[model samples]
Every structure is written in structure tokens, then in C-alpha cells.
Target: MNIPYAIPECRVAHLVERHHDHLVVPVRLDAATGCCPECGHASRSVHSRYHRQPADLPLSTSQTKLRIEVRRFYCLNPTCRRRIFAKTPTDLLAPHARRTRRLGEAQARVGLACGGAGGARLLAHLHMPASRATVLRLVTRMPMPDTPAPIRVGIDDWAIRKGSRYGTIVVDLDRHRVVDLLPDRTAPTVAGWLERHSSVALVAWDRSTEYARGASLGAPQAQQVADRWHLLTNMRQAVERWLHGAHARLRSLPLLPGSTVRPARRNRAFARSTTELEAAAQSRMRWQVVYDEVRHRHAAGKPLLAIARALGLARATVRKYASAETFPARLPHGAGPSLLDPHVAYLAGRIDEGSENAMALWREIREQGYPGTSRQVHRFVAERRTRPVRSGRKPRSAKASASEPPGSETLLPPARQLAWLLVQPTSVLNESEAAVVSRVEQDDTARAVTGLARRFTALVRAAGKGNPVADDRDAAADIEAWITKARTCEAPAIATFASGLEADIAAVRAALMEPWSSGQAEGQVNRLKLIKRQCYGRAGLNLLKRRMVLAA
Candidate 1:
């Protein structure tokens, strides 16, 4: 040591072992093994060493590689006169396999956890041979969460794709995490799942019947709370239905068929400019002429059916163009010298003279034998604030009066405008539109419309009045009464649709009474629908079910 100690070489570079049950195998061996791995034989003499290739994690800009100098041993045991064998590790994968154990696990996740096709693609991208089936296998291996009996559980269904088929999804209401996905959305399948997990105390679900059936059958003691947002949505649909029936006769009804129906391309659509428009109009005129010729022929003792057949026209289309009600609504002639009629000259003279106060003018007009109300006068005057130009281009109408030119200066009075606004719907109606409604609705149905408009206006005013909010408790009670009336209309569909909700209306009402809302959950349902569609691309039931439950 005093002279200089020679450094001893390290023989053992690394070691990797594989364990199977009670057996341990040295898959990767160090250079120096004092004792034999296959047999207990000590050796000080070095017999031989060779490189053993093993899989490793990929390195940056390089494919991963591992080389180990595994030891070869000589069993000097007289009883065991056999050659020593090189050991293989069970923890390590088989030779020639590129993937490591952990990498395989992650691949399984790509297949099992994500949507099947997506998982397949992802794994393939990662150089894994994962098919949709392989992905499905991974899903099968995942353990179902042992969700504790949640006080409030949410039940719904997600299809693999839109219109493909659906599977029941249960969520832990308290945790807001997915609990279990069932095989089908049918009553029996979902019911079986619920019966197995029977301690659920409360359930929140949509207005779907099968889920309700399953819930009623499986969790009889559970209190059901229907999604209120859905209830309100149903109410809205009902209102829209009424509106559709009420306004059915309006000419501008949006008659485009369901999105699936395609409209024939009009030649006019390709035209871009006024010249093109004129050309398109001429083409339309030509068709109109043909149609009129057929009609006149029919009217002058020739048969319509014969004329239509001779002209190669679809009989129904022929009738549509020829016999259609040419005059729908008759325009009212000279209703009056509208408060509008005076706006241009009146506001122009006043504003020109620096005496224009539309509000004051509204009152003056009301006093000056103007049949219309102050609100109408105000609205008319207010509309002219744009100070539109009177272009020297062709005049649009002979109806444009001296006082009420097509382009005129307008004035508005604050009180009069507000009065006009009170006559309109509380929602969606613009101020100008509201004013028009205020003026036009002054006829036969005006009073009823006015009463409703006023009530809504009062409600709005009260909201903005900084007045202490009166107790809406009575109002809420009245809504409940209305709800009861609405329920009577649903007794037939109620047996199916409104059953779970109806039976649980008390609980639902309680849920509604709570400050919390089911809006988010309902929104989640919609999101699920979108997800289902994207994942499955309109798949069949089994495929759809698989996609929905397994999709990421």
C-alpha cells in the first residue's frame, strides 16, 4: 500500500432477473458469477462470456438497445456431470420482442381505455400491432370500479355513435365520476346492473323511459329527481309546437325539409351580379310564361291534367305554379296617414329649426288629430336618426308620400318610444320591431296582446326597478299549479315519458327548489351524444356500445 495499490477491475456490470411463481431466472447475467446460477457450483476460473441482447427503453434519436455479458458456468459437481446453461429472466419479455413489459402495458391502455378505432390508430402510430379487437381485449381487462352506494346517482345512456345504439352509463352523483357502463340501454340489462348495486339511495336521470323502468324496478326505494333543464326544454318544445300551429298560415314558413332532404340547385344560385340576377329573373319569367300558358290553356276549355301531361310538367308542380292561391293576404289600403307619414317633414322641419324634440312632437301629433298613439309617433320619428340620403336613383314606390319620403330624417321621443316598447314581446323583439308591433297591434287582437305585453313589461320593469323583489313564493306556487294543469295533458304519454318524472315530481320539485341546477348534467348528456357520434361514425349496437364505454 505504501508503494501503490493496484485497482481491482469490477466484474459485475449489471444483473436482471425474472421471477415466475417461486422460480427466479437470471435473464440478464453479470460477467462474474462466483457460483453457477443453474446449479450450485463455485468457480474462480472464468470459462467464457458472451453478449446477450435485451430490450430497453428507446433513447432520443436512437432505437433502444441493451447488451449484457451473461456468464457461462461449469458445474464442477461430480453428481451433476452436465453442461451449465445460460439463464433467461421471466420479468423480461421473450427474445425478438421489441416492446418492454411496461410499454406493452401502455399499449394495452391505448387499446382498452380509448375508443377502439382511435386506440388502434394510436398504438399503430407507436409501432404496436393493436387492432380494434385488441383494444377491446384491453377494455375487458379493466376492473369495474367498486363505486360505493352514492346517495344521488345519475343514470343515462351513451350510444357508440349517434343512432347506432346506446349503452347505459351510471355516474356517481356525489363524486361526478363515471361508475359503470352497462351492455345495453334496455330495461333488463340496466335493471340487472342496478339490482347488483342496489344500495343507490337517489337517482338523477333524463326523461327516457327505459332508464326509468330500470330505476323503478331495481332501486325501488330510491328517490328519483328528474333533470329540470330537460323539463323546461320539454316545455319549450310544447310552446314551439303551439307557436307553429298558430303561425302555420304565414307565407314565410321555413319549409326546408329535415337536413337529410336535399334541395335542387337553383341556376340563380350560381349567378353573382345584378346582371346575373336579371338573367335569372328572366329565366324565371320564361318558366312563369310556360306555367301561365298551361294555366290559360286549361282555363280556356283545355284539360289541366292533359296540358300538364303534354307539357311534361309534374302534375303536382303544375298545380303548385298554376292553381296556387295567387292572393294570400290582402294588404290593407290607406289604413291612415300613419304617424309615420308625418315623421320626415315633421322631424326635418323641427330638427332644421333646432326645435326637434321627438318626445314633444309625439305629444303634439297625438293632440293634432293624429289617430295613432304617442308611442307610434315616437317610434316613427326615432327611426329617422340614420339621416338617410335621398338617392337620385329610381324611386322605389309611388306610395312614398311628400311627408314620408323613402329616405327621410327621423325623430324619437323617449316616453313615446318606451310606451311603444311596452307593447312588444319581452324576448327577441328589437326596439324598432317592438315599436312596429305597438303600432300595428292596436287593432282587434291588440288588447289581449297588449295585456300580455304589459304584464311581461311589468315583470321586466320590476326586475330592473331596484324594488325589493317581492316574494316569488306565490308566483312559484302558481307555476306549480300550471304544472299540474300541464300534467293532465300528459297522462297518456305520461305512462311512458313522464312516468319516472311524474312519480318523482315531488322529489323533482324539491331538486328544482334547491339552488343547485341540473343544467350542467343535461349539457353533459348532450356532450355524450356528440362524443358517441364522433367515435363510432354511426356504428351498430354492439360496436356503438363498445365505442361509447371505452372512448376516452
Candidate 2:
């Protein structure tokens, strides 16, 4: 039978033997001499003969194994350190290996694409059986391809263990491939990496000071460019923060002609139980006391450790309280969606139709496949019924009531929602969003904030599109002018944000001029996260680094 595989200097001697699901092919070496690996001496005299069986790729529906008849030749050179050497096809298989070179490569690729256990399950179905451990071993033994030197690179931090540990991912911006992964996001770690890649002429990063310092220390000749996306993101956050403090104004803004407005309660106690209000007030007061004490202690030159100890609080908590420019509001508790959520629209329709009975509403929903109890429907009806009732008021005529739509109530957008509308381009805003924007713009402070946010967004988009600039100096001047306006603006949050930009002026300016950004680096981080999840936490940093650098 002819040999299906290309085994150098070898020939198929015996016919294929089929045993259950296995197919074995006996192979014989045809080489006349063997070379000594120790001294490079060739010998033709044979000392012994033996068989070495190694697994190969599957054949049809059966696992194939090559039973290679190998010869052990005596070294002709007495000066050689080795007494004997094996005559085998080195190109086909590695010494002391149980699989051919081609087979090992296939398994390594499988291991990389599908992690350990996943690869093993896949290989078993393909008739090339291997354990998870074996698959990982193949992946580790596989050599890494050499990467070309990079001219432009972007660095970003990725969460290894979110909210706690983080690592750095370095991507070659020009080639659009990951170059290396660091164990930590520290400046020293990043600097050491950059120092090794001296070919890098430009380094793109975020507004992080650690990355900025690292690039400066490692590659001073390389110009650092801040990511444009991150700049806009930070601006959006500043707008949101400012809106949080000025949210009361948003409530008083005039509603659109057809917009819904929330009805006010005559009795404030009806909004929430008196007990709930008192509890919330007491909680807020406690937070205010702690917040004030922490700020005062910090202002008086007290260390975070001392403050935490004195307050019986964690260092992180104390530090958070001290770092805030404004007091952090306690987040309201929001309940998760219930089994009754899908039936809310149906329930509302019944309620508006004058069906006030909770059991009746529950029965109607149950017919529609709602699995929740009547108590859930009862709570919903009770909340809606708690609005203050008018005593002895004249009822509206049927014609007057029919003029307005049913359930139409005035609803004011929240501060967070308003902040988003302000920063977004007008072209993307819908009719309702545009109406909200128009109303907010009526106030001088809101209009100014909106103008500055829109202008900043436009600048970043223009820079990102790589439009031809009239002059680098002109673009810088525009940015500088915007910064000046933002710094002296009435909004303190935005002013502080603008001051931070002025502090990182060099990198920010480079961001406007250079086309390179960390966008591709962020994409690589996403891919890394996928691979990390595949490992199921069994793989360590070294293995993860190998898979990321090698896998597609």
C-alpha cells in the first residue's frame, strides 16, 4: 500500500491493520545512515532495531497510528560523546514524542481556538482523541511566531479581575495586531515594555497618568496621543455630573404641548409613607455627617488610614468620601423586573377602562398567561390609587375630557437623560428629544453647557474623521479657546474637567493631530476577554498571554 502521509526517507512496509475504530500503518525508515546529535558524526553500521509507534491524523473514520521501524546506529567516531543514535525522520516527528509534527501542530491550533476542555471534546469527535491536559500541553509546546517591530503602538488597561486587578494590552497600531500583554498596569511595567520596543515612534493611550508617565520615561522620542473617544467620554461624564447638581431646574422647565406631565400630590405623605420619608431623611443626615467629617479631616492634613480608623470605616470608603467635589447622593433602591412585568401594559389598559378590582385584573392577566399572584396586581393598583383626591370639585364634561388623550400626564426627563440629549448631535435627536433640548436651552446656564458640549463633540468628531486641517496651529488655537471658555464657565464640574484637559495639553494636542488612536487596542482587549473566559480561570497569565499572542 502507498503511504498517504509524507514521512521523509520512510516507506510503508506492511498493509494497514484495522482494529475496532483504530487503523495502524507500519512504516520503515529507508535512510542508510544516522547522524550523531552530540558530535554530528554519521554512521552506517546498525547496532539495533526497534519500533516506535506515534499517533497521526485521522484516516476516514478511524484513528491512524504510524508504527515506524527505527534503527539505532553505532557511532563510527570514537571521539563522539554518544555511543549510539537513532535513525528517524526528524522532519516528520520530534524525538521522544508520541505524535507526528503535523499532528501536534493541528492539536495546538485546536487548543488555541477552543480552550483546553473545549478542544478535547472537539478532538474526540474528530477521531483524534486527547485529554484537556494533553491539548494544553501541545499548545504550550508550540512555538510562538516572531512579531515584526512596531512603529506605532497603543496601550490600554484591561480588567483581569474586574474592579480589582487589571493588566495592560499592547497593540501594534500600524499592523493592527496585539504585540504583548503585561501582568500589571503599573508605570514601571509599561515603561519596561516600551523600552524593549524602541522602534515605536508614536504611542497612543488614554488620559491615565500612569500610561503617560510610562511612555515619557520609556520612549521620550515617541509622541504620546490621548484617545479621542476617551476625551469625549470624560466630557459626557462632566456634563452628567453638572446636571446632577442642577436637576431641580429641569423639573420646573416647561413641558412640550403634547408631552406628559407627572401629577403632583396634594399630600406629600401620599407619595411615600411617612415612615419611609423619615428613614430616608435620617439616612441622608447620617451620610452628610460622615461626608463632612471625612472632608474636614482630609482638609486638615489627616491621612486616609487615620481617618478610616477614627471613623471605623474602610480606607477605600474614607478615600472615596474625601475625593468627591460634591457629596455623593445615596442611590435609590430599584427592584428587579417581576413575573408581572410582561403584563403591565394589559393591566394599565384594564385600570384605565375603570376596572378597579384587583382580583378581576389578576384574572384577566392570568387568562393572558401571567404567572404572578393577585397580590402583585394589588400593589400596582394601590400605588396608582394613592394620588390625592379632589373634594367637592365639579366633574369635567364628557366632551372636554374626550379632547385629551387617556392617561396623558406630564413627565419630565431625568438629569442623566437630559445630559445625554445635550451632548448628542442635533441631527441624531428625535422629535421628543429635540423638544426637550429646546426647552432646556431656554435657560442661560443650560444653553451655555449645551453649546460647549456640542462644540467639543464636533471638534472630536472632526479630528477623528481625519479631515484636512487648515493648519495645526489653527486647530490648537480652537481647542485652546474652547478650553478657556470651559475653564471660566459658570458650571464648576465642566470647568474642572476642562482644567484637566489643559494639564494634559501635549497629549490632547497630539490626539487632534494624529490619526492613530487606541480604538484598535480596545478591540484587542475585547478579544482577550473572550479568550480569558474560555480558560475558565484554570489557565494562568503565561498561558493566557500565549493564546492571545498566537490565536486569531
Candidate 3:
């Protein structure tokens, strides 16, 4: 800012007063000066005058100074009887400040950017010097941003001291900065803030019901925009739920599949040029072979136990594949030529040749180099006898054996039948369980639903965990830890779930702990000081604040 100076007569405004910290202006007063600023009392005699400090532009090259003619006046009103008062100026100042308004604002920028010490160091590097304490005081005392009421607001909670306390940071979506903060992220606390500042047209927040309750309470008219991230998080937790609920069903474990290949340790031997999709496809391909072999053996009357042992896998994993079929198992009712496709021709020819017993077929198969165990050969040959009367005697024993589940325990993927069995209640029969597991493993729709159910149940279970009987107060501490994990997720649904669980968030966080808060917003205020420090070789406070906000 440039002040036009005069000594009764000036050629022109030759000197442009530029302020690096703040700008100052001179005001003249005499017995005939102007109206009294305080008490509305008229004054007529002047005490004395000099240039009083006023706000100026910080970061200016020249040591810009305010040349104000300060004055003391006597109240003429008999009723008031005041002796003398220092007349105040119109621009920016509280009372008794030696620094100008511009200078104070400048201090705010520097203090907030680099912090006190950093700002002080940088300021000293410039012409005008000040202590870190002075800079910090300005940062604290300066007014926060106060734009008028907003139509749309965003509410969220963030941790100040994680697992201990949380604070709410509200933002006017339209302006996009700090609106206000609540002491706690609880429903009522946030609701109160909303009620006080209630013009919000929309409340965009993560899926936490605390904020939801607050939004409902404070800004009843506002529409809630549940963040997509929150929704996904909730959905994922829901899937985990089904996994938990299905835990009991996993009783009959199978063998796990092992990898046949390993990555090369030498950099030069590694395949670096592969694309992401190609690499993923190869990874899938590795498991696909094992999956195919397992399914084939399952269909061929080789029990999961034998195959898992042969393949060196956990029984549970073998069961997983075997039970890949959807729940509510379907009956093997197809009217095929034989129960076994590849074995049917052999069975028909053997039956035609009058070789009827299981021993004869097993003996014949052994001569053909069957590497698998004899029991599988028996099961397959017996399956042939169970078909119908037109070809041969269809034995009830053979039929029952076909329907029976392979009790071999290795953690393998369940056959379509076993998957349904795993999801069923324990009260059911093995045959019925097998049928149901088969149904579930086959129906994509049912499987999808169960997956979601599993995840949700898991999350709930996780949330409920506290000091279990196994632990002491550590159980309570454990619950708090889980909730903290839930809160930190950037996804809205996850945060919202954690928020909704606010009531049961745990004993430790029950009081001072915050799951979410706007401490980062406050941190940004401090960061503004660092940014200012880095660039404050010479800069104005207004420019600094603007830069900090924009850059941030």
C-alpha cells in the first residue's frame, strides 16, 4: 500500500511506501479535529501527537512504516468527566497493540507455516525480525476463517490421539476448509454443532451412524451422501461376516494345494517385461492345473483323502475344491449312459464279456497300469454296476457308496457336494449335508450372498471382541484396538461402521478417545508456518496464507 505524504505542498507522490510486514497511515488532529471515537463525547483540545503504528504489507523490500499522528483528547461532556484517552484508529487493531494490523496478520502466516522457531528464524533472515513467541502468539490469537453459512456440509471424525480420543471436523463443501470442530465425535456432540450452524443442505460423510444421528438431529433437512468408500468398507466387513458364520462348516478339512514352481532369485533370469494382466493370468494358471486334477479325481470315484495325500495337500484345501459347488446340493439325476463317462464303455464291454464282479474289473484295470489305489478302481467298477438292469445288476450297495462322502481328511477344496456340506448345520446327516453343500457350491447367487454374510458376521465378531475370559482388561484393550483399525480405514463404509459402533467402542475410549477427528486440519495450520518460512525471504502475510491454503 502507498501513502500519499504532504508537507503542506508536495510536487507529486514520489516515494511509494511498501510494507514487508504491515502498512501504516498518518492521521492529523487538532482542537478542531473530528468527532470523539469513544463514549460519543465531543472533544475540543489536543494533548499531543505522533505517527502511531498501523498494519502494513509484510515481505516488502523497504521497511514500510505507518506514519499516524496519534492523539490524546479531553471529553467536553460535563456528564462524562473523563480526563484523557488515546484515540483509536479505524482499521485493524484491538486495543494497545504496538504492531499494526497488517503486521499481526503477517505474524499469523509465518507462525502457522513453519511454526514458531522456524518462522522466527526466517523472519530474522528478512529485514524485520521477531521472536518465535511473538509469532506463536499471533498464530493463536488471530481469528479463524469465518465465511458465512454453507448450504452443503461434510462431516467426519479423525483421531487426535488414536484409540484414545476423537474430534469432529466439519467442512463447508462449497468453501472447502475448516468450518468448526466438536469436542467429541459422538452423535449428540456433532448434532449440537449442526444445530448451531444448521443450514446444511447435504451432509456427505462416511457411514458412521454417530454422524448420521448428528446430521439428523442438527440439520434435519439435509440429505446424507454416504461416501462410496464407506459403503465398500461396510460391504467388505459383511463378507468377512459370512466367513465367520461358516467356520463351523469347515469341520471336515482338506489338504491345501502346493505350488510347483518358484521365482528366480537372479535379477537377470527374472521376467521383468511381463504386463500386469499376463502375470496375473500366469498366477491363476498355476492353481488351475491343480484344480482340474482334483475335480477330475473327484468325478472319477477317487476319494478326496487319497487324492490330497497323493498331491501332498491339506485335507481342508482338498475339501474346499471338492465343495466348490454351491449350497443346497443337487441330486446326481442326469440320465447319462453311465454314472462315469470314461469308464462306461469299459464297464459295458466288461459286462458284455460276463465279467460282473468288482474284483474282475480291478484286476483288469491293474493290468492297464492304473497308478491310483485299488479302492478307487473298485469304486469306479462298482459305480458301473449301480447304473440299471438293462446293462447289468445295479447294486444298492454300489449306489450308496457313490452317494457317500469321502471321509479322508486333507485340507483340499471340497467337491461341489462337500462345499454345501461345510455351510450346513451339524445336526444334518452326512448325505443331506453333502447334498446341501453341493447345492451351495454350484449356485453362484447363493455363494455370493453367503460370502457377504460371512464377511459381515466376521466384522461384527471382531468388533465385539474385548477382554475375553482368556485375558483380563487386555480383552477390553483388544476391542479398542480393533475399533481403531476400523477407524483408520480411508473407506467411508469402514469408518462409518466404526462410527456406528461408537456406543460400544470400548471402556478406554468410552470417554476421551476419538475414532476420527480434524487434527490434520489444525496440523495444516501449523504447516502454513513452515511453507512461509521456506519462502519468507520476504513475503506478505495475506499472500502467505493464500499460498498455504491453495498449496495444501
- Using TM-score as the measure, the top candidate is 2
Q: What value does the lDDT take at residue 221 in candidate 1?
A: 85
The order by descending TM-score is 2, 1, 3
Model 2 global lDDT (CA atoms, 0 to 1) = 0.81
How does residue 424 of candidate 2 score in lDDT?
96
Kindly report which residue stretches of model 2 are placed more than 4 angstroms away from their true locations once superposed: 38-41, 78-83, 248-355, 364-373, 383-412, 438-444
Sliding window of 10 residues with minimal summed lDDT for model 1: 1-10
Which residue runs does candidate 3 get wrong by more than 4 Å?
Answer: 1-34, 37-44, 49-69, 73-80, 83-88, 92-94, 144-146, 241-446, 449-552
- Per-model C-alpha RMSD: 16.5, 6.2, 21.6
Error of 1 at 329 (Å): 13
For each candidate, how many residue pairs have backbone atoms clashing (under 3 Å)?
Answer: 8, 7, 124
* 48-146: candidate 1 lDDT, tens digit per residue: 767655434433222333454455566676676566654333354445554445555666566544566778887655545557776666555554444
**C-alpha TM-score for every candidate:** 0.46, 0.82, 0.44
TM-score of 3: 0.44
Weakest 10 consecutive residues, lDDT, candidate 3?
Answer: 263-272
Best by lDDT: 2
